[model samples]
Target: MRMGLVYGCAAEDMVTGLTIQCKRWKPVYYNPTKSAFLGVSPTTLDQHLVQYKRWSEGLFQIFLSKYCPKIYGHGKISFGAQIGYCLFLLWAPVALPTLYYVVIPALSLLHGVPLFPKVFGLWFLPYAYAFFAKTAYCLIEDLSSGNTLNGWWNSQRMWVIR
Candidate 1:
């Protein structure tokens, strides 16, 4: 009951929440009929990117530090919780592969090097399906959350930038 947020972390809330969870505390989500909290969001793209960059860096730091869920929460928390933390914490590293995927293909095309199968090849079906499925899922999720189509498009742009 006397617990306070751990200091020296960029994402103190996340670090504190993980610490509380590791201490065997079960968190509850309360969604009232009305909003319980109101917060301001970044009003510009630069602000949004800076905020996300800080978040990603902090999460990555946690992934590399002793506070890493897989390491610190080994026997204290459930495997699902560890996996969830790893998923969020791994975002910064994930950007590496994303960067390669975005850039390598263009460079290969410029060099006339064939990196992938033809558009009509049988092996291309899986890639096509994965891309479209993820896109549709994201669109449905955004729309379900009450975001406009323009907002969804902007989100897609931000995903690549982040």
Candidate 2:
């Protein structure tokens, strides 16, 4: 990890770097750091949009690159941890497919059409529940960590952009 500084949008590249290091050699003791003095500087909505775009784009770039989690991260970490980390890493790219699915239901509603044939049998329910469950889990974690209303609101806004 010390060979290079992998800092970029949302720190996705940094995560890859650290994961690779961990795969090669486990740390005897790992200390995750936080800063009480650190805070995000408030900016205009346009600036926030630009920042989000940059972050997602950076993550997407990493996803497309040779350093992708599946390519370099699979055997390095525990299987479950690797899967979870890859899912998190792929979040931004997955947003496009998620948007398509959501928009179809929205468009069907707008057009006053049935969501699907009654016999179609809610096949998407499990997937929807998984998404919701993950979201709720993250929100609960954030709240338990003393997140403020502004922090929650900001995170929601960023999620929408994603």
Candidate 3:
């Protein structure tokens, strides 16, 4: 079935909804790589922020309104794929995890709180190493793949919009 299409900076909600609906009802295989690739505009940073804000607000509105993947996604998708999509949805708004996992722990040490205890403290070494390693890996992957600028731009666009 051919679905009527809709998309714009302000139309993410509709686009997102249509995608889920199509995925739910259509038996045809859907390849995300074959989906639309947009070329966003805004020569100035201020204008970029304006567009970003509009898109972010729309996405957040979708998330809040039960059109999100986890809610409407249901049996239309596999559980693991649904979880992955949900994580993507949460990536923008879950800033507190960054603060909780990274910032608060560092600040606590500065305040003379015992950063770790005697027995389980050793876990911190592995945890910190894993965190750093994952971060470095992502950075290296982005740079090596020549996605650095694009990744940074998308991140910047999402940051303020979230």
Candidate 4:
């Protein structure tokens, strides 16, 4: 199980790197007008990006078992990054309120930790929002979404409302 997770994480990283590479080179890619100066054409550049994106996104997905240490520890990279990222983002929406509103009384009266009401109060809303937002976007892209830029931008939009 451990080795399998590691290999999957590595594969996820490679795919992610490939996507980044394609995105990085997007502007520099040949265009008929621009490439004519050198010797290539836009079609070739488009084709190249298409190939790279196809290979990467065709199998694209994040790994969560991303284990590194500081970088992190043994874990699934895709699952770890996406869901984990959601964890923190969702956390932000609640952390402040929990501290001021619930943590103190709960910790003092209950065990060493915040009470269920305190924890639950902070947990559900942000979590549900993040989950739906991320899931909808992921599912939409996985099936059919030719506008890669839009897909990427929308996914990013999850972090910020605007």
Candidate 5:
């Protein structure tokens, strides 16, 4: 049977690639000394956000549909591949928790309600550690990937926006 790119998806490339992988075909990656392809990136924040939203929604749609990696990919793909697909596909649903974390804390603070333990409390230690560790890890990862501090900050901002 002949295989082609899947249609009717905002992220057709991603859907097609996932489908191909599920068909037990291994993909090849070739990295040469020179650039192989050039593409234009979204120039403005609006354009970037729009593109991101579309891609994320498409991934979420797949997750909700029968094509979910954990569902359709079961037995067809390796465990690690299914996990990797799930991580990317779950991006949109992650926004709900992010929203709750951002908005609830602020609203609680505004109402003089403490949503977390005091800084000196034992429970605070875990929260503090998690926050600092995640921040540090993200910073290190961004820097290691050749991104500047500003770039890391911008990525964090974009994460919240998305």
Candidate 6:
């Protein structure tokens, strides 16, 4: 949970009507997080939050449903694993372009090619650093607090069972 800081997106702060899209994969009954930009309304933020939670729950069910898990897999796979893969795939549009613009050029320059990127990697360094640093910090916190996924681990140390 400590790593949640980096793992989760920013929380809604105000009731600003947000214009959004319908999730491509969601069922009609599970319609969630779809929004439109409207003037400040007290319900806007709450609605958005409700919508996001709904979408998250829907996705959770879609990827983790008992009836559907056989297709998506369950014990061998797990919900988080599936979602992480999907999320990684989703980042491809931006990541691919970024990789092409940055890594490719850097490698080309290193190989003595004239085609060198303008070093946008430096621009993204802060964010990258912050992400890893926060993850590491949260991991340490979790370890110290003994509040890991499987509950308190250190509190149950393995003893030599005669």
Best by lDDT: 1
Q: Where does candidate 6 clash, by residue pair?
A: 18-36, 19-36, 19-37
TM-score of every candidate: 0.79, 0.63, 0.54, 0.21, 0.76, 0.22
lDDT of 5 by residue, 61-125 (tens): 98888888889899988899899998999988888888888999999999999899989998999
Better of 3 and 6 by TM-score: 3
Whole-model alpha-carbon lDDT for candidate 6:
0.42
TM-score leaderboard ranking: 1, 5, 2, 3, 6, 4
Model 1 C-alpha lDDT per residue in residues 62-144, reported as the tens digit of each score: 88999899999999889999999899899888888898988999999999999988899999999899999999999999998
Per-residue lDDT tens digits for candidate 4, residues 61-87, read: 332233222133224334444444434
Model 1 stretches astray by more than 4 angstroms: 1-4, 143-151
Candidate 4 differs from the real structure by a C-alpha RMSD in angstroms, to one decimal, of 16.7
What TM-score does candidate 1 reach?
Answer: 0.79
Instruction: Provide the lDDT at 146 for model 4.
Output: 44
Rank list by lDDT: 1, 5, 2, 3, 4, 6
The Cα error of candidate 2 at residue 153, in Å, is 3.7
Local error of candidate 3 at 106, Å?
Answer: 5.9
- List per-prediction Cα lDDT, in the order shown: 0.88, 0.68, 0.63, 0.44, 0.86, 0.42
Candidate 2, superposed: residue stretches over 4 Å from native = 1-4, 7-42, 116-136
- Give the better candidate number (2 or 4) by TM-score: 2
Clash pairs (backbone) in predicted model 2: none
Candidate 3 displacement at residue 19 in angstroms: 0.8
Superposition error at 72 for model 4 (Å): 22
Q: Any idea what lDDT model 4 has?
A: 0.44
In terms of lDDT, model 1 sits at 0.88
